[model samples]
Target: MAVIIKPFSLTVEDYLKQEEKAIDKSEWIQGKIIKMAGASANHNRLTLNLSRLLPLERGEQNYEIFVSDMRLWIEESQSYVYPDVMVIQGEPEFTDSQQMAVTNPCFIAEILSPSTAGFDKSQKFTLYRSIPQLQEYLLIDQKSYRVELYRKVGERQWLFTEFIGKDAIVELEIVNIQIAFSELYKRVKF
Candidate 1:
C-alpha cells in the first residue's frame, strides 16, 4: 500500500488510465479513488509467505499467483482493489486492453492491519462477493497467527471457518489446497 490521494471521484475508465501512469497504487471504490494505506513489515511478510507457498499447494500449472501489485476490479460494486494475495484458477479477465486490472479471481487473501482490518472484513469483503468467480476470501492477521476464511457455498451464502495457532492448517476447499498456519506467519515479528 502507498499514500497517494485524489480530491475528486474518478470513473472506472478514468481510474484505470490514471492508475497506470501513477507511481504508486490507489483503489477505486464506488466512484471515489482513494489512496492505499501502507503495510507493516509483518503484513508484507505474511503476504510474501502465502504468495510463495500457494504455488506449491495449488500447483504452478493450474493457478497463477498475484500479490498486491495487481489490481482486481469488481464490476458489480464498481471497485478496484489490490489484494494481499490472489489466485486465479485459469486465465484472468482483464478490465481493459492494458491488462492492468483483473475481473475474475477464484480466491483472494488480504492481510489484516490495524488501519484497514475493519474495511477488509466488512466493506471490502462485501464488495468482493460481487464477483461470481470468487470462491474464497482469506483474512490473515498480522498481529497473531490467525486466519479467517470465508468460503462461498451458494448464491449469497458463505461458510465461515477459522484457523488459529502455528500448527493449524488453513484449507482452501475451492482450490483443493492446504497451508500450514506457521508457514503464513513465518518471519512476522508479531
Candidate 2:
C-alpha cells in the first residue's frame, strides 16, 4: 500500500523567518507555503520591458516601480505574494520596519505564464481587490500581444479593458501614462 502524508502548514511568522534566509522566493497563502516557479525567457523579457518602460513613461510623477523582488502583503487574505511588477504612487507603505513587505501599491502588473494564468486572473485578482489602495490591476500575456486591465470604478466595482495586437496601447488614467504593446512586448518573442 502506498502511504500519503499531508504537508505541514507554517504560521505566518514562521514563513517570514524562513523566507528571509531562503534563496528562492515562495508565497504564503492561508498558512500554506507555495513555491514559485522559474520564469521563461519570454516571461523575463516582458517583465523587464514593463519595469523599464513604466518608470521612464511616468515623467515628473512620483511613482516608485519595483520588479519581482519586492513582496506584497495582503492583510485580508493573510497572504504574501511577489508581483511581477508594482507601481506605487507617492510614498510606499511597508508592512513592518524590516521593509521587506509592502502594504500599499496603486498599480500592479503580472506577466502571465501558462502555469499561473488561471490563478492570476481569478483568485489572485480577487485578493488584490481587497487592498483599499490598489487602483489598477494589469495582466500581460507572454505568449501573445495581449494585455488586460482592471481599474477600480466604484465601491466593489471594476472596469475591465483589453488591449490586443502590436498596435494596441494601454492607457492608464490613474497614472496618466500610455504604453504601447510594441514597447511592452519589446524583444519578447512569442
Candidate 3:
C-alpha cells in the first residue's frame, strides 16, 4: 500500500484536535504527524501476547497495562505517543482533554514494523527516555525472534539487554517479573 504522507505543520494542540477525528491510528512527533502502518502477523502476535501477559502479571494495585490505542504524553517535548503495550504505575496526572493519554508509564513496549523500525529504535527511544517515570522500554523484533530491553539506571543512563530463543527469559525489573521467551511466542508462527 502507498503511504499517504501528510505534510508536517500542525501544532501540538492542532494535532491532538485533528487526531480525535482521525479514523485510523497516527502519532505526532516533533510537529510531524505520521500515520501508523498496519501490523504484520508477527507484530500482531507479539502485541497480543504482551497484552495478555502483562496485566495478569503486574500487580493490580501497582500498575495498569494497556494495548495499542492509549496515548503516552511527554510534556517537555510537547509530543504524544501511542505505544504497542504500556504499563502505568501510580496516580497519573492527566489533562481534562487528554484523559485518554497517559502522563506516566512505567514500562512501554513497541513491536517493530518495517516502516517504523528506524524511528522506533532511535527517535522514539530518545523521546520515551525523557519520561521521568518510565523505568523500562521494550522493542520486539517481528522478523527476528528477539526482544531488546532497556532498563533505566539513573537520571540519564539506561542499561540494555537482549533475549532470544526459547531458553531466554525477559526480565522486567520495574515490576519484578520474568517472562519466558517461549511463552511470549507460544502461538506465533515463524
Candidate 4:
C-alpha cells in the first residue's frame, strides 16, 4: 500500500481560540492562517463598486454584503477568507462575538491582481469550492474590463463564463442578478 498522510483539519472555533490579538489583516486557508495583502487604489475602487451593487440588486433583503475587511468562515474546509466582495442570503448565520466568523455565503467575488491571481484562481478557488453554500465565484480584472463567473451547476461542479470589454455585462444565475461592466470598473484608472 502507498503511504498516505491524513490532512489536518481545523475548525473555526479552534482557529479563533489560538489568537486573541488581531493583526493588521489575515486569512485562514486549510489549516494555515496567512496574512492578507494590501490593495491598490484601483483594486479598492473595483471592490467598492462591486459591493455597492449587491445590496441594490438584492434590495433590503436578508442577504448580507461585505467588502474586503470582513471575514468569511468556510465550514466544510474549516477555513476563513476575506474575499474582495462577499454576499450571503437568508439570516445571519454566525453569532456576534469578539472572535466571530462567517460560516456560509451564497456569492463571492475577487478582483484579480498579478500577485494574487494564481492564488485566487487555484489555491483560493479550491478553498472556496469547499463552501457548500457558495453559489457563484467571480474574478474581476482591474487592468482590463474582464469578469469571469463560475456558477455552480451541481454540488461539486462549477460552470465558467467570461465577460470582456467595457460594454459587456456579467450575470449570476445563482442569485438571478446582473451587473454592468461599468459598475465593476467605476472610477478605475487603467
Q: Which candidate gets the maximum TM-score versus the true structure? A: 2
Please list the C-alpha lDDT of all candidates, in the order they appear. 0.84, 0.86, 0.80, 0.76
For model 1, how does the per-residue alpha-carbon lDDT over 61-114 read when each residue is reduced to its tens digit? 477788999989888887888998889887877877878778888899999887
Tens-digit per-residue lDDT, 57-112, candidate 2: 46666888888889999999999988998988888899888889898898999988
- Assess every candidate by TM-score: 0.91, 0.92, 0.90, 0.84
Off by over 4 Å in 1: 1-7, 56-61
How would you encode candidate 4's per-residue C-alpha lDDT over 39-88 as one tens digit per residue? Answer: 88888899888887776344455677777777787766667777888787
Return the TM-score for candidate 3, rounded to 2 decimals.
0.90
lDDT leader: 2
lDDT of 3 by residue, 1-190 (tens): 1123478678888988888798887788777777776777788899998877774444556667778888887887778778899887766566565477887888999988777778888988999999899999999877767999999999889999998876788988877778888878877777
Q: Which stretches of candidate 3 lie over 4 Å from their true place?
A: 1-5, 56-61
lDDT of 3: 0.80
